[model samples]
Target: MEKQIAIIGGGIVGATAAYYLSTLPGGQQVKVTLFDDGLGQATTAAAGIISPWLSKRRNQQWYQLAKAGADLYPQLIHDAQLGTDVYQQTGTIVTREIPTDLELLFDLAQERRQTAVTMGSVTTLTAAEVQAKIPLLANAQPGVFISGGARVDGAALVAGLLAQATAKNLTIRRERVHLTAQGQVVTSLGARQFDRVIVAAGAWAKELLAPLGITADVRPQKGQLIELAVKDYPIQENMPVLMPEGERDFVPFGHGKLIVGATHEDDGKFNLQVDPTVTADLFASAQRLMPSLTTANITGTRVGTRAYTSDFAPFFGPVPDHEAILVASGLGSSGLTTGPQVGRLLAGSALYGGTPDWSEYEKPLATYLKPSAE
Candidate 1:
C-alpha cells in the first residue's frame, strides 16, 4: 500500500513541498493532498525580495538557513519550471544614507562571497553608476550592488509549484482544516487519516495545532505592500531591487510597474484591513527615495498576515511527541527567502521517516511546538 501524506497551507512552503513530493526520488511511493484556506496569506502579499546577505540581523543559524535558501533558488526554479516573470535574478542594490556605511556593507559582501560564491559579484556604485542603474532615484546615493540577488512573485510561485504537483496527481482542496489529537486532518467535508501530516499553515498554525493540546509559538504579523504604475518607464522592468535601510524597500516588475512597502506591524494581529494612513506614509517614503514616483499612479495594495516567533527565529521538523505531524513556521519577513528550502526538507523527512537534522538552522522543534500545561 502507498503511504498517505497531507499538507496544510498552500503558501510557499506547502506549495513547494507538494511540488517536491511529486518530483523527489521516492515521492512516487506516496499519495499527497494539500489543503489551503486562502486567507490573508503573506506569500501573495509579500514584496518577494530574495536578498538576505545584506541583513543586519544577528542570528547565525538564521543567516545560514537564509543563505542556503538563496543558494537553492537555481535548482528550485529549474525543477518547478518557473518563468522569468515569476522569479528573476535582476540583482539588488543596497543604499545607505551614509557613504561610510555603504562602504562597510560592500566589504561585508566581499567577505561573505568567499563562502557564498553564488553571490556572483559585489561592487560599490559611484554616484554616476547608481544613477545609471536606477534613474528614478532622487539622489544618486552611494550603494552596494550584489549581482546574485533576485526577486520572486510569491503567488505566482505557489501557482507554478501546485501546477506541477497536480500533474503528478496531487490532490488540492480550497478549505480550512484542523487536526485531531491522533493526527487526523478534519476538513469541512470530513476527517481523513494520513500516515504523515505537515502543517505549513503560516500564521494560522497556532490555532490549527490547538486541538491537539500543542501550543505553537507562532503569532500572526500583519504586512502590507503597495504597487505603483509608472507610465512609459520601460526601463523599470530591468531595475534591481532597492534595499534602503528602512521599511521602504522597492521591487520592480516588468510592464512599467514598481512595488514599495511592507509595514511590519507587530500590533496588527490577524487584521487584514488596509490602512490609508500607512499607505500614504509608504508612498511618501518612496517619493523621497525616488522623486519621480510622485507622478506614478497607485495601482493597488496587498495585505497579508505573516508568522513570527517570540525570538524571531524559524523552525521546522516533526512535533516533539507527535512524530507523524510535522510543521514549519515563524518565517517573519524572510519567508520568501527561506520557505522553499524548508519545504524541501519537510518533504524529504516525510518520505524518509525521520526528523530532519536542522541543528544548524534553528532551535529544536520542541522549543517552538510544545504541549500546553495541564
Candidate 2:
C-alpha cells in the first residue's frame, strides 16, 4: 500500500512540492500527480528576484522561509544544469532617498538579530557610485545600500522542474480539478484517490476549495512588466534595483535584456493588456534609475496574476477537519523567493504527520475550519 499524493497547480509552489515530494525519504513508494490548468503561467510570471534581506518583515517565519528558499536556488540551478548565468548573484541595491520606511526595516533586522551594513549619511547613490555598479545609471541620484540577493530565470526554473519531475516518473496533468466531499479529487481527464491532496492552485485556490467546505482567503493581484533589449547597456552584474520604496523592482535577465515591472493592482483582471499609464510610469521610473535604458529597445510587455493572501503570507499545512486535504497557496509576490522552502516543508508534512511550525507566517483562513455563512 504505497502512499499517493495529488497536488493541484503547477506554478512555483505546486511544482516545487511535486519535485520535493518525489525525492522525500522513501518517496519512491509515493505517487504524486500534479494538476494545473494554466501550467506555470500565473504565479510564475514574476521577475524571480531572490532577495531575502530586502524582504525585511516583522515576521520571522516569513524571513526564515524566504531566506531558506533563497539558499536553495543556487543548488537547484546547479542540479538542473541550468547554468550559473541563469541566476544573477550580483546582489540588490535599495536607494536611501526613496522615502522608504527604514525605521521599520532596521527594526525588523534588529529583531531578527541580522547584521545590516549602514553606510553613513548616503540616502541615495551619487552618479559615480551608480555608474561604478551599474554603468547604465551614470546620471542617477545618490543614496543607496547594497544587500545580498540573487535573481533567477523564474520561467526557466519552472521548465527545469517540470522536466526533472518527468524524469523522476511523476505524473503531470494539464487540466482543472474538482474535489469531492471525501477529500477525493477528480480532473477532467480522470479521477484518483490519494492519501493526501495538496492544493497549490495559486489565485484559484479559493475557488477550488470552496466546494470542499474549505476557505482559502486568496485573491488575484494583477502585475505587469516590460522587457527591454539593451545589447550595449552596462547593466550591473546580476544586480536588482528596488524603486519607489520597494513598490516595484527592476531586474535584468537573459541575453542583454532587462525586466521592469510591476504595478500592484487589485482589479481582478487577468487580461495581458499593459496599461499605458502603468507602462509610462514604469518607463519613467526605470529611466530615472538607469539612464542608459533610455536607448534600450522596448522588447515586449506581459501581465500576470499574483496570488495574494489577506495577511500576505502563504497557506500551508492541512485543511482543518479534513486530514487528507492540504493547502499551499497565497504566495503572493514572493512565490519565487519562498516556493522551494515551502514545497520542502509541505512535502515533508504530507508524507509524515506534522505541519512545520511557522507561526509568524499568517494565513487568513487558517482559523476558519468551515465555510462562513453564505
Candidate 3:
C-alpha cells in the first residue's frame, strides 16, 4: 500500500515540503495532501527579509540553521526559474545608530569571515556612504553591509512552490483540518487516515497540537507593516535592505515601492487589523529613516501573526509519543529564510527514520525546546 501523507498549512514550509516530497527519492509512492486555511496567513503578510545574521541570536544551532536557510535562497530562486518578481539576493545593511553597536557588528563580521561562512563580503560603510546608497537616511549612521542577504516575497514564493508541486502530482486543498484523538484526519471535504501528518500551521500550530498532548512552546507574535511608494524620491536601483537600528527596517519591493515592517507584539490577539498606534509609529520611523518617505503614497498596511518559539528555534520532527504526527512550526520573524530548510529536513526524516546530515544542531535544539519535558 502507498504511504498517505497530509501537510497542514500551505505557507512556505508546507508548500516547500510538498514540493520536495514530490521530488525526493521514495516520495513517488506517497500520496500527499496539503491543507490551507486561507486566512491570516503569516507567509502572505511577511516582509520576507532573509537577513538572519543581523539578528542578535548567538546560539550555534540557530546560527547554523539560519545560515543554511539563507544559503538556500539562490538555489530556490533558480529552481523555480521564475522571474525575479519576488526573490532576489539584493543583500542587507545593518546600520548602527551608536558606536557600541558598530563595534559589535565588526567583531561578528570577523568571526563569520574566519569560519568562511557565506555571508557575502562584510564591508564597513561610513555614515555618509549609507546615505549615498539609500539617500533616505537623514542621519546615515555607520553600519555593516552583508552581501549574501536577500529579500523574498513570502506569498509569491509559496504560490510558486504550490504551482510546481501541483505539476508533480500534489493535491492542494483549502480546508481547515482537524485531527481526532484516534489519529484520524478530517476536513469539511471528508475524513481520512494519513500514514504521516506534518503540521506547518505557522501561528495556528499551537491550537492543532494542544489537543494531541504535544507542547510546541509556540506563541503568536503580531507584526504590522506599512507599504509606501517612492515615486517622489527615487532610491538607488541596487538598494540593499536596511535595518537602521532601533525599531524600524526598510525593504524595497521594486518599482518605486517599499515595505517597512514589523512591530513585534506578543499580545494574544488574532484580529490582524492595522492598529492606529502601530501605523503611526512605523510611518514616523520611515520618514525619519528617509525624509523622502513623506512624499511617498501610503499603500495600505498588513498584519500577520508569526509563530515564535520559546528557544528561538523552530519546532521540528515528530510530536513526542506520536511518531506519525510530525511538526514544523515556530519559525519566528525569519520564517521566510528558514522555511525551505525546515521542509527538506522534515521530508527526509519522514521518509528515512534517521537524523539528516545537516541536522547536527537538532539534538541540542531539541533539548532546549523541551517539546515533552519530564
* Cα lDDT computed for each candidate against the true fold: 0.87, 0.68, 0.77
Name the weakest run of 10 consecutive residues (lDDT summed) in model 1: 230-239
Please give the lDDT score at residue 255 for candidate 3: 83
lDDT measured at residue 16 in model 2 versus the true structure, 0 to 100? 78
lDDT of 3 by residue, 1-374 (tens): 78888999988888888888887898877888898878878888876678777566767776777778887778777886755667877778888878887989978876776653667788888988887777655777888888877777787888888888788758988889878765678889667888889888987877787666555577788888888877534544457888777748788766877888878888834778888888889898888776766634687798877887777677677766677887877788878888888988887777666544545444433542344333
lDDT (Cα, 0-100) at 109 in candidate 1 = 93
Q: What is residue 9's positional error in candidate 1, in angstroms? A: 0.3
- The sequence of per-residue lDDT tens digits that candidate 1 reaches over residues 256-305 is 77888889998897899999988998898788777766634788999999
Query: TM-score for every candidate vs. truth?
Result: 0.97, 0.85, 0.91
Clashing pairs in 1: none
Model 2 bad stretches (over 4 Å)? 98-127, 143-147, 233-247, 291-296, 360-365, 368-370
RMSD of 1: 1.4
RMSD of every prediction: 1.4, 3.8, 2.5
- Span of ten consecutive residues with least summed lDDT in model 2: 115-124
TM-score of 2: 0.85
Q: Which scores higher on TM-score, 1 or 3?
A: 1
Highest TM-score among the candidates is held by which one? 1
Please give the clash total of every predicted structure, in order.
0, 8, 1
